[model samples]
Target: MQDAGFVWNAEELDAFIESPRKHVRGTNMSYPGERRPEKRAAIIEYLTQLSTAD
Candidate 1:
């Protein structure tokens, strides 16, 4: 992803989370993607919690 010029920040993460393959062509991720806005938000929120947990 670094080679693709992806900074992997929140905005980029959000886009990637929405559509992995579309956002990063050639991605190995097989997740069709979360079509629901609330689900996506929950996923991001959960990931945020995981990152901040200590």
Candidate 2:
């Protein structure tokens, strides 16, 4: 999370997954975010698991 410069929560992760560029203007990351809700939810779930497993 050091790279993000902030603590990520559920809503923040959802928004970020929807659009990285829109979330953080002028970010170098060019990766277009997930268009499918299921996929995005999965990714967020996985990330959450990582955070909690620590």
Candidate 3:
């Protein structure tokens, strides 16, 4: 899945990590309206750092 340019939202990401088939519906070629993992991960990591900093 990572080989192709597939993006995932928060809910989508959660669902995907848990079960790719269940969450991923419709088109297999593309993930309808989703954010990139790198972007999402960066945001999450940043938030974690901020929380820890506080």
Quote model 1's TM-score.
0.79
Task: Go through the candidates in order and give the C-alpha RMSD of each one to the true structure.
Answer: 1.4, 2.7, 10.2
Cα displacement (angstroms), candidate 1, residue 36, comes to 0.9
Clashes of 3: 0
Model 2 TM? 0.77
Q: Which digits, one per residue and each the tens of the lDDT, describe model 2 over residues 1-54? A: 236666678877887888988876777777899888898899999988988894
TM-score on alpha carbons, each prediction: 0.79, 0.77, 0.37
Candidate with more favorable, higher TM-score: 2 or 3? 2
- Model 3 residue runs over 4 Å out of place are 1-34
* lDDT measured at residue 9 in model 1 versus the true structure, 0 to 100: 66
Tell me how far the alpha carbon of residue 8 in candidate 3 is from the true structure, in angstroms, after superposition: 17
**Per-residue lDDT of candidate 3, residues 1-54 (tens digit):** 554346644555544644455455543644343346666566556765777794
